[model samples]
Target: MIRLPENTTVFDDGEAVARAAAGHLRTLCEDAPNQRFAVCLSGGSTPKRLYTLLARPDYATLPWSRLHWFFGDDRAVPWDDPLSNVRMVREAFGTPSPIPETHLHPIPTADGPEAGARRYEATLKAFYGAETLDPARPLFDLVLLGLGEDGHIASLFPGKAALDETRAWAAAVPEAGMTPFVPRVTLTYPVLASARSVLFLVSGAGKQDPLARLSQGEDLPVGRIGGSPLWFVDRAAAGA
Candidate 1:
């Protein structure tokens, strides 16, 4: 059985998890001290629901103008591909979404994973206005993450060299740990760690083992996340 961390918040179901995550995001945006709030989005069914909720009229008060959206990882496929995180996000938000076109920064993957990773890193550096990350100043206000059954966070899979990367803000995963098996570009740990808040949204019974391993003090990629990360999981994922 998984012994959930003290920071974990168990929800009744996946829908409740999405709702609570939406609320947490709203609070974070509202309370942000900076004029511009950056958010790193995660990809998954659970987060897709959260993104859809944010795009709805009910979340109109979320200050869309000041909030910038970014992706933590994406497959090296066309933006419109079904497996593409960019496609999923665009479809979830629907037409006439409040987020400005310039505000949604998708990882560039058309030029292949290597160049795409480099370009995306440049984009992030430009947005941060500095090449070097300062611990005192975070690159993002909130970062949303999902726990893979293999304990991978973003595209940094177990035993992958990307897990040891300490320089670049983003790195290319030429070979993924699992399907869709396409090449991917992912933000490195330092970039992810440079967020004011990191929230892991996990659901489904399949996630129980990973959570259990984390509880047992296994050094999964998720464990390397800084900033005192919090977990928001459904009962099934918590091994309830």
Candidate 2:
């Protein structure tokens, strides 16, 4: 485990982290002043539990009609593919969930990574009602993120060219640092930073090395995220 910042919260395990994240997310939705609220969802195993919990009674009652869902990143694959983040999220939400179909904004993967990224960028702009992002007016009410073992966030891998993106809200990764090396489209740091809140969920003993590196201030891609991120970590990841 690595040293955590003052804003970090340590949990007994991954389930505990998921529960806390769900509670915090619900609060964010309930407290939002706007009738329409946008939330950027995280991809990876860590968030599946949170999504499932949200589908359950305690959170299923949230104002799904007013909430808009967006993905932080997605592999360039068909929506129904087993490796597709969209598929994972859909299954986790379960059938007959209250979330509106039109409100779930997925990155279009029909035309490969580059085209998909461009299309997604347009979608985000349309939703944001502007081509350029304004710092004062965040694009999302909250952005959920996960820390990769290599210190990547979303699909922004460490030392990748995508990490340098500043102007574009979204970009394509021709190659990934890890397996399933398929192309991916991810929201850039600038876009990710334009959020009311950025939350990081870290779990498992396998995450210890990367967390340690982050704690030591290694300037990895995850560390480049703009806002003061809130971290939800399990004891195994925190080395508590």
Query: Compared with the true structure, what per-residue lDDT tens digits does model 2 show for residues 36-149?
Result: 999999987779988988899877678888899999999999999998999999999999866899999999997999999999999999999998988889999989999898
The candidate that wins on lDDT is: 1
Off by over 4 Å in 2: none
Least well predicted 10-residue stretch by lDDT in candidate 2: 1-10
- lDDT by candidate, in order shown: 0.91, 0.90
**Per-model root-mean-square deviation over C-alphas:** 1.1, 1.0
lDDT of 2 at 173: 95
TM-score, structure 1 vs. true = 0.97
Checking candidate 1 for backbone clashes, the offending pairs are none
